[model samples]
Target: MDAMQMALPIVGIVAAAAVTFYAVSFAEIREKSFEDLEDKDFESGGFKPSFSSRQRRARRKADKEGRK
Candidate 1:
């Protein structure tokens, strides 16, 4: 019984911390979702080709042209 009395507060504290963590996580996700929604105002919908991929494609195109 004495242990239970001491443990209840600890359990409550941990539960409250978990709830706060989840609430903040959810809020961040929601904020990011809204930010992405706003980002769709761009032409490509927030998609951009990586620099290395573009460089590789350009190199391949040049090689093909040189072979021709």
Candidate 2:
């Protein structure tokens, strides 16, 4: 029941908490798959479809609007 014994357990618990926190963060950072990165880049940059495909889509939309 002395202060030394009391302090030992507290120190151990704190150390365990710090180690666990670091390990989880490391695993999370490592878990970012390449596919996930590509998806993020595509989302951030907006969709970059081929120019021909985009022009076709625009024409189709215009045609639909003209008939409306």
Candidate 3:
């Protein structure tokens, strides 16, 4: 077989795999959206920040006792 003919199928397989990966990723994100809406962490006013976003936790600097 010609080199071009052999290469074309390989390219097509890679393209198909990429399309499938994206489709599954989007589906999982959509499912997570519904779960987030049902979460109990929301504040009375609005959604609460995730644990990692809290003021104390998000601070990167050392505390007064630890500072030089």
Top model number, lDDT: 1
Model 1 lDDT tens row, 1-68: 69999999999999999999999999999999988877775566565545698899999999999999
Highest TM-score scorer: 1
lDDT of 2 at 43: 58
Over 1-68, each residue of candidate 2 has an lDDT whose tens digit, in order, gives 89999999999999999999999988887677644655765656755556698889999999999999
TM-score of each: 0.59, 0.49, 0.57
Candidate 1 residue pairs that clash: none
Colliding pairs, model 3: none
Between candidates 2 and 3, the one scoring higher on TM-score is 3
Clashing pairs in 2: none
Q: Model 1, which residues run further than 4 Å from truth?
A: 42-68
TM-score for candidate 1, residues paired by index: 0.59
43: Cα error in model 1, Å: 6.8
lDDT of each: 0.89, 0.83, 0.80
